[model samples]
Target: MGKSGSAGPLMTLDINRFNGVPLHLQISEALRKAVSNGQLQGGERLPSTRSLAGDWSVSRNTVLQVFETLISEGYLEARVGDGTYVKRQVLGDFTATSATDERPLETKASYPFRGLSQRGKALIAHRLGGLTERPTLFMPDVPDLQAFPIRSWLRLMNEVSGRLKGDILVNVSNAGYEPLRDAIAQHLRTARGMMVESRQVIITTGSQQSLDLLARLLVDRGDPVWLEEPGYVGARAALMANGCSVLPIPTDEEGINIDLGRSKFPTPRMVLVSPSRHYPLGGTLSAERREELLDLSRTTGAWILEDDYDCEFRYRGQPFAALQSVDRDGRVVSIGTFSKTLLPSFRLGFVVVPIDLADDFAKARAVIDRHAPIMEQMVLAEFMHRGLYSAHIRRMRSLYAERQAAMLQLLDETLSYTPPEFECAGGMHFVLPFKEGVDDTAVAHELWKDRIVSRPLSMYFSGRRKCSGLLLGFAAFRAEDILAAGKHLAGLGDLIRRND
Candidate 1:
């Protein structure tokens, strides 16, 4: 009932296209369909499992499994050393099914996800993009992987594996390790001028976790949270996910316009500030505005989140004083990250919260993720204790400073590009402001084809075109690379201005 390999035909499988399915599964299903459909005739010599695997861009074992499944289903047979072949009875099952259409499975038409608890479905059903690739940078938010101290980290990891003991292995300290929290507190006091105690510091996996914890700690559903317009989109996503209404505070050269933000929200329950060097535009909140914002928080009894995102890379003389330094009302949650300064894999960050809210935040953290890993906490604590962490910051501080200068210098060399309407004070990125009538997004698409990703400032805006610019980053770029990136920007300028 079936033809042989001598049927003189062949079928090929494609694997490069992104079907958005696992590669191996895609391969297996493709082969199964061919065999069941008789397109791959019976008794045909199949490609060597290894050969098929090569075509599929997958491993040989995966192909082997596919072959094995077909054999088990009587659709294929192995002839040992020579090769595998399709079974002669391959068409037998087809005739049995072709006589009449098989009834669809009598499974209940009820919800397939009924078994999942309501919370489970809700958790998975929730959607947020750009978390995996926030800021939409060409380089991405990760560290230069080649530069990670793998040997040192592995040594620390080995030490952890060897010394893991009863309480260390089994106990989950929801408050994070004491050494790590203390170390963060010490670092903040010395470097940031934020007077915080060890108990006031809550270790987090990353800035994201810190944001989520704060949202839960401070915001009730439908409460108002004010953030800089065209600000850190990640923070906006976190607040929105927690059911808070995010009010965008317009940012000027002096950072967020404090009085206007207060007027808009009138009674914002919480305010998020990136005072040292504001995001996207990279402008610092002027001292007057910082004080004014803190005063607003104090008067209104609203909470303040001082997101000191990358203050360590302040390219100038002295760093700005943190808002927490002037926060006598115990209202500020000072968030800082190692992801920017030392490395990204560290996933180590801390939130300096008020003493009264520390316990509650800890409880919320427990519900969220229990706590960050003790081993990482221990290694990072040791790194800081050895002064290595500070040493790295001092080194990278200068490195990013030079990179920033280089990006600016290269921009000056090209005449094609227009000067950005908005400028950064001292941060990793600067927004190139665009005119109101221009289609900034179309320009962004043209740049993508050139492999240069600059974020349109308006993409960060939630309302009408309150601000328009492009956010370029140098946080993870070397000084030389910064020059090239600027040239790329210049080339883009040539293409864009040519239209004019």
Candidate 2:
């Protein structure tokens, strides 16, 4: 049980007798032995309760008690806010018997890490702030909540506040609130055509939290993770941070190509895709490709993460039902977010996992952030029950449909003959693939000067591929604005067509 403080990240424990001796006691003994034996000398910060929860396969409360017991015993120090750090002084001095030898790094605090050390800042830095401060287009993912049904929300919140008994309010389900999950299950079934029970839905703080939870649960270091070539960059960053080797899959007009993904990065354990509508590209996955993916998952025992990102605003005919509806093999984990559907800042989303993995996934979530903000969950549930969510979505659908039409007409009249192959099927954004070799970054840079913000296709690549396209989100923009931006991009589009 000696913890080579800097050795392996986890310490294995006997869990077969879990129901007997409290888990914290076992953990305390294991940690104390590691320190006394000098395997763990000093000054090592223990993994946060969230991190240990995943490793021990136990609750955060269990780990919390373990820390408290060890701290009281002088074996560990609870620094409170900054997390628990191992006190090297616990063992007095291990090198007191040895001749005093000092190294340069030893003398210097904040020494640069030797390449292999875990203390180094990650090699692959995350690129962010794309739309974090109000998307360049000035319309971000969140709706102006002030314009939403705030009065009705406040009334229901007041009602929930009044009804909450002390014990009922204090209690929590490791997965989430049961009534909220049931409400979400019903909402998905009636609105988005997904079939699942409340038991399958695990609520989260937006899709980012869902990605973090999935990485902790499924991915080991360097496990192959396949992502769309021109996809959401933030998702890639999340997977990479968890030590997954991300492989990029090229997209055609009909969404992610299954044959290409399987042939290219064939050994990946998980494939992430936005099948309902291709992200940025904004095309539905052809039926053939959808079946091919499910077939691949069933045959290879791989799990598919279907990000049903923005199916709510179809703006056309009935949007395709989620891919999980037919995934009978328990290989699909469907994630959806209200970030775009209602508001982004609300940061409420859920993952519909197979029933078996639901408990473990919740354990992983509890490890990360104990249940999402309860107040927001309560408000959303009330919104759904009082029929405001449905009405709001219906209103947004009509508004976005008009905006998309106006933008398309503006494009046809001002710039190109047509946009990409997909036509307003569903999504907040659509792609206009530039002629090959047309630097999308340069084009976007030019657009930025005019305050007409457009995302370059190359930015989405996993630092691979010579992709040239522009991703323009229409839902966030008003008709007049998209019209004006189309005019500016047209001035740039002419240069492309002429070069062609």
Model 1 ranges off by over 4 Å = 1-143, 415-425, 485-487, 494-500
Clashing residue pairs, backbone N/CA/C < 3 A, model 1: none
Q: Write down the worst ten-residue block by lDDT for model 1.
A: 94-103
Q: Write the per-residue lDDT of candidate 1 for residues 1-500, one digit (tens) a residue.
A: 65343333345776655668766667666766666655666677887766666555678888888778777777778885557876767644443222123435544455574475543443344342232343334443444455556687677778767767878876756778888788888888888888889999888898988888888778898998898886777788778777788898888778899889877678899988888877766677888898898888878888988998877776665678788987888988888888876666668888888999889888888888898887888888877777877877777667666766776776567534433433434566655556665666666666776667666666677667555545666666676766756545664453332224
Clashes of 1: 0
Clashes of each: 0, 2
lDDT of each: 0.72, 0.74
Per-residue alpha-carbon lDDT of model 2 for 299-359, expressed as tens digits?
8878899997777878667678788887888888888788777666777889898998888
